[model samples]
Target: MDIKKITLFGRKDVKVYSDRPKNIQSILSNHLENLKDKEAIVTEEKTLTYLELDYYSSSIAAYLQKKCDVKKGDRIATIIGNRYHFPLLVFACAKLGAIMVPMNVKLSAEEMEYIINHSKIKVLVSEEKFISKVEDIRRRSTHVIPEEKNVFVIDGKNTFNKLIEPDYPLDSVTVDELDPAYILYTSGTTGRPKGAVITHINVIHSLINYQKIFQTHEDLKTLIAVPMFHVTGLVAQLLHLIYVGGTVYSMERYQNKKYIEYILKYKINFLFNVPTIFIMMSTEEEFKNSHFDFVKKVAFGGSPIYQQTFQMLKESFPNAELHNAYGATETTSPATLMPIKYPKSKVNSVGKPVPVADIKVVKENGEECRVNEIGELFIKGPMVIKEYWNNPEANEKNFTDGYWHSGDIGFMDEDGFVYVRDRKKDMINRGGEKIFSIEVEDVLKSHELITEAAVIGVPDEIYGERVKAFVVGRKLSESSIQKIKEHCQRHLAKYKIPEFFEVVDQLPRNASGKILKNKLKEIGRK
Candidate 1:
């Protein structure tokens, strides 16, 4: 509970939680002493206690160390989606002081191969379903681990069986809090993904930030529906619970029905997910009929929660506290969090900086912006990753001073709350007027008939670019389009309103529910 100013990772005067665990292993060890017998993980296949998870990971870690020659600071990659085995491998990596790179399951073989070669992954664990992609990568290139020896499968028979034989003792390894424990690749929506090297110091500060904001305890049980590849799933849901000695429930995939069933079946008390998941769930009859009064906390990010979805969640779980979180992989999952009380007046804001986070908004010309003036956000904190893995070009371009330039464009309110406008790349320029896509989309969503909205700029000869909007709602008719234009006219400026409107069933999204703007531009081209 002590805040201290100390030198960390060559940086002086950085804020950190004094007396924090020296490494990830130490934090797990402290929890194991009192919570060894408590339920640690619950999955569709089986439930594991803290003692069992520890035991299993020890045997697995010993196998990797003894057989694969995995030592401190080696990179271990997992392609198992969101199963129990994912967390099993996480603990296994933690025990060995190894860095984990949880591969994105939705990527093509070529994309996956790029990561394998880039990270130089020494060991790989994959699910039976995704083995073919691994085989393709193996056949196409010699840059990855061999299938006959170093590669292990989760639900298939292979050398993976030796990992659970119960004879290998997990030995201790000395690891510093500043040592890299994770390398999460960026979303790569723009180009090739770059890996963010996160240290144990980064992870510890992030865990403490969540703890201070949420006041989590050993009794807390949260369900994870997101993939482990993301910081939201790995650091926010899994590692945070491990640090608090709390229970975690895993969903191998996100399904609305299964989501309703799991929360009711497990008596889950906490929920963390993107806004799209909550929006999709609200439409189901099972969700509408359910009583989730037992849930105490709900946190959502990736996008702001709209008014309708926010109201639905409030009415469903009257006792729950809904908090908005704003973060990225480079920031160890949270840069800003909604205040503990979640004041309704600031519902649209992402809220204030986490205790350790220091943010500065800057203009395109690189000067600091005045309060309430929109610009890009640069974040500096002990929780922020020191640098990207193996990419000095990106490192030089993305960081300034000690802060990581979070390409997201937004502004800080007079009250210190942060409001994320949109990605800098998504902003539309018409003649000399600039329009943030989110501002236009937010106005469109305000219409009672519009369920969702996305905006993009299409090439135009007159203004260089023009606004286009994609809306989802009741089957579109000519009258509906006219009505939408009228609604937009009342709220948005003439320059900001879309020149084109396309009614679609749904917006394209990645596995994490982030809208794919690149795909939308392609559609706009046609």
Candidate 2:
């Protein structure tokens, strides 16, 4: 449990602060008391100090307790986005010991209803844009609302601000570190979204992991372009900034040009997002002309980074350190991180295990794999969630002994750097030879005419499955396809080379920018 045992490359023996706040409320209170006047949150609309954030959240908690009868362990579902009100509601629920369920704003009415009813959410809050979807769900959802007042909108007449009691005193609610704080739903590509129950201790430990990995200091300013519903935005960026008493500038949504504008406007020092955002930014003309001198560190995750994009980022931000972080929603945010001073030799690796977590690659027989051998990755630590919400089958299947069986296929080098290959189900088998789709996609991305690439296995009568690549780049021509095939043949083995090539304007992605292979399979069928 001693986090200081994990050493970095440059700093051999790094000491991480072990003492942490018991719950989210305590973390917020500490910042409020010590950094009251410091700028806590910034948006295009307004700015809030720590003192104001505490007061607003406390007042909202008091109102929810008195009016809606919200109590400890009650579920409050929010369908809001990256606005200041989103965090206000999150902190309010944390203060009252209620579990916050941040639903994805892009989900359909049926999808929203499934999560709402399954979580048994007592209160529902949504933005105006999504109010119609909430109404649709309320008409058919199994979870009944006692009254219309239980539902609050962010911009409509029944807004969250109207419920705020400015002078009302919030009753103190006792919260344990082990208590459930929030339940974040997975992308649910395979089936219905399973909610991952994250505890207060898990979040605090994750904050410590980020702090040690990023070497956080005071006055650190970050621009949050990712959605708040994601662990990367909530735990890694927003909450971590608050834990360090730093400033955060949140965007309602991500636009490549606007993201650059905010970076300069806020003088952002830290940047964290998925690889797609960075790739889009690097391709923009404004990004090439803008100055990124204020950016000190750039961290990305949720998917593998192509070598071409990595080099683009390195050249774009010469002063900043580019880090490729690796984790899932089950592990809070990050389990392994490539350090700022990482070597070029291990550039493809996701670095070593973080200070608070441990990782191992294991075979189907449950035996640990040797160096450079591909196997399923398993993560263990205080930061790892113990189970899914109300999903006993998933808990039984995914959790073994104290480790969560991450469904990712990867390997570790002799130097302890982890290299993620592909998802367990994403691996393609042609005849007896196994092929990782990511390897082919990475090679395709390196091609001069290719902007993005996705490789999937299509059903083949002889080989069971054959490699097919979907690319977004120059117009497809006989010569262009031949050129790409030639490039793949040079880099990959004969069997690993894609047998079919399809040119598309774009690849389908989930909210986190991960390529949806399921959708690609549907395309293959057509």
Candidate 1's C-alpha runs over 4 A off are 477-479
lDDT of 2 at 314: 85
List model 2 lDDT by residue over 414-480, tens digit each.
Answer: 8889999999998999997989998999999989888899999999999999999998885555569
Candidate 1 lDDT over residue span 1-526, tens digit each: 8887776656567778887888877767787778889999989888889988888888899988888889999899888777778788888888899999888998888998988889988888887788899889878896575546778887767556777677766667888888999898887877899999999999989998888898888888999998878999888899999899999999888999999899999899989999889888887899988899999988899876777777878898899888889999999999998877856888889889998778999999999999999899999889989889999999999988777899999999888999998888998999989898988887888887788899999999999899999998875655698889988889989999898999999999987788999899999999
* Per-candidate count of clashing residue pairs (backbone under 3 Å): 0, 0
Model 2: clashing residue pairs? none
Model 1 steric clash pairs: none
Runs in model 2 deviating more than 4 A are 1-18, 474-479
**Top candidate (lDDT):** 1
In terms of TM-score, the best-performing candidate is 1
